[model samples]
Target: MIRTIDVHKSFNEQEVLKGVTTEFFPGKTNLIIGRSGAGKTVLLKILVGLVTPTTGDIFYGDVNFSQLNKKEMRAIRMKVGMLFQGSALFDSMSVEENIRFPLDMFTSMTWKEKAMQVDSCLERVSLGQVHKKYPSEISGGMQKRVGIARAIVLNPEYLFCDEPNSGLDPKTAIVIDELIRDITIDKNITTVINTHDMNSVMEIGDNIVLIHEGKLAWRGDKSQVLESTNDTLQQFIFASPFLQRLRAAALERSQEG
Candidate 1:
């Protein structure tokens, strides 16, 4: 699990995150949702140690990540896996090579061991046959799957995905969301995903954090989200006509049944 306590981040005079406090539980898909510039990305970066919060503490499991030394942080980072917004696969490398890159950089595993790891991850993501293909040769969704396979190759205890469903069709996006959620439960990984995708929220939001104007507006599960009375959350979520209708219908069906 990951927890942030009164976190604050700023750029020059502009504060991006304002005293944000939240806990992301393990074995679940923890979503951070907000509009652009709402500090969702900044929070994700701070959680992953890519950016330092100006004032606040972050805890990974029981350890206070904000207080860790550089070497200690590096060790924690090795336990982390990140799937970038764009899939971020190397254009030149084959899928196998891309998935094996982490082991090559971080482990002393032999070629055979690395290959075995790569094969396992690819199979897990259902991309085993595309191992020899380059990123350009596959569709966007396949590339995202390869990215996910690579992220999990090390079997990280903490997984972070930034806008993971970006650039994919709605159908493919839902598939990726379910895949991430399933892997999180199966591996019991502390998974954190940054996205504004309401579809993802309704589908796989085991834990949801709603950020508004750099502050944490609400936190709860999917069921609680629909029942939440927070004005900001309601406005943000029900702003879409489709989601509004869906929520209304769900409420009505529940009442009638």
Candidate 2:
């Protein structure tokens, strides 16, 4: 699990995260949701050691990440996998090569062994047939799948996804969400996702953290979210016409039943 205690971050004179505290449990799809500028991205960066908080502690399992030295941080980073917002696949490399990048950088394994590992990761992401394809040759969803494959190739203990569903159709987005959740459970990885997509929230939000204006507004499971009395959360969630309609219909059905 990943836990942040009283985390605070500031840029110049402005504080972006205000004493945010939360835990991202293992084997679950832990979601950080908020509007733009809510500091969800900053928090994710802090968890992954991209940016350090001005104050507070970050724990990976029982180890305090905040106190790690450079070498220690490098070791911890080796155990981390990140799926970036844009899929972030290399345009110059084939799918297999992209998956092999981490193994090459981090391991002393032979070429044959690395090939085997790359193939296994591709199979896991259901992209085994596109080994020779470059990023431009694949569909957006397939590119995202390749990104996921590369992320998990090293068997990372923690996975971080930034807007995993961004720019995909609804069907594809749902598929990606399911894939991420299934992988998390199967690997028991501490998975943290920074996303504003409500569909993802309802689909795979085993643990949900709502950040509003840099502060933690609420934290709970998907079911608890539906029944929450937190006005700010409700307002943000129901602000979408589609979600508003969904809640209204759900309420009507509940009453009729």
Candidate 3:
């Protein structure tokens, strides 16, 4: 599991996060969601060591990540896996090379061992046949799958995904969401996702953190979202009239049931 203890961050006096505290359970999809400018991005970056918190602490299990030096942080990072918003695959590299990048960079394993590992990860993401294709040759959803395969190539203990469903059709998006959740459960990885996709929330959000203006406004699972009485959560989640109507209908059904 991963957790934050009253963590805060600021840049030139503009505070981005304000004493946010929460725990993200392992073997589940922990979602950080909010409207734009709500500070969810900052918090995700802070958790991944891309940004530093001005105050308080962050913990990956028992170790205090907040106090780690560069070297210490590097050691901890070896167990981390990140899937970028853009799928961040190298344009020039084949799918196999992209998935093998981490192993090649960090390990002294022979070529055969690296190939086997790459093949295993490809199969895990159901992209074993696309190993030789370039990112441009595959569909956007396939690219996302390749990114996921690369993220898990190291068998990371903590997986971070920033908008895994971005740029895909709704059906493809659901597939990606289900794939992420399945992998999280299978690997028992502490999975944290930075997303604003409500579909993703309803589908795979085992733990959802809603941030508002730099603070943690609410935290709950998908099942509690429709019934939640928290105003901040309600406003952010049901901003559209169509969704508001949907929520009302859902509530009515629940009452009848």
Candidate 4:
């Protein structure tokens, strides 16, 4: 599990995160969601140790992550996995090579051992035969799966995903969502996702925190979203006419029952 205590960040003189505190539970999808420039991205960066918070503490289990030295941070990072927004696969590398990159860097495992681990992760992501293909040769959804396979190659205890469904069609997005959710539960990893996708919020958001203007405005699970009357959450969630109508219908049904 990951916990943040009064996390605050600033750039020069402009503050991005304002005393944000939250906890991301294990074996569930913990989502950081908000509008553009709402500081959610900065918070994610801080959580991943890419950026330092001006005044706050980040905890990975009982260890103070923000106070760790380079060597200590490296040790912790070995057990952490990240799925980038763009899939971030090397164009020149085949899927197998990409998945095996971490093992090659972090372990003394033999080539055969690495290959077996890579194949296992690929099969877990349901992309068994794409090992020889380059990133350019696969569909966008396939590329995302490849990224996921790479992220889990180390069997990480903490998984951080930044916009996992960024560019896929609605159907493909749902598939990716379910895949991530299933993996999180199966591995009992502490999964943190930074996303603005409403479908993702309503579908896989086991724990959702809404950041608005640099602070956490609300927190709840998917089941509580529609029934929530918080103005910030309502405004952000029901922004689209379609979603507003859907919420209306849901409320009407609830009233009848």
Q: Which candidate ranks first by TM-score, i.e. highest?
A: 4
Error (Å) of candidate 4 at residue 158 is: 0.4
Candidate 2 RMSD computed on C-alpha atoms after optimal superposition onto the true structure: 1.1
Pairs of colliding residues, candidate 4: none
Each prediction's Cα RMSD? 1.2, 1.1, 1.1, 0.8
Q: What is the C-alpha lDDT of each candidate?
A: 0.93, 0.92, 0.93, 0.94
- Clash number for each model: 0, 0, 0, 0
lDDT of 3: 0.93
Q: Residue 166 lDDT in model 3?
A: 84
Model 4 RMSD, rounded to 1 decimal: 0.8
Model 1 pairs whose backbones collide: none
Runs with alpha carbons beyond 4 Å of true place in candidate 3: none
Model 2 lDDT at residue 21: 90
Candidate 4 yields a Cα-based lDDT of 0.94
lDDT of 2 by residue, 1-257 (tens): 89999999999999999999999998999999998999999999999999999999999988999999989999999999999999999889998899999999889999999999998888888776898989999999999999999999999999999999999999999989999999999999989999988888888999999999899999998988878989978998899888888998997998899
lDDT of 4 by residue, 1-257 (tens): 99999999989999999999999999999999999999998998898899989999999999999999989998999989999999999998999999999999889999899999998999999887898999999999999999999999999999999989898999999999999999999999999999989999999999999999999999999999988989999999999999899999999999999
Q: What is the lDDT, from 0 to 100, of the residue 23 in candidate 1?
A: 97
- Looking at candidate 1, the ten consecutive residues that score lowest on lDDT are 122-131
lDDT score, candidate 2: 0.92
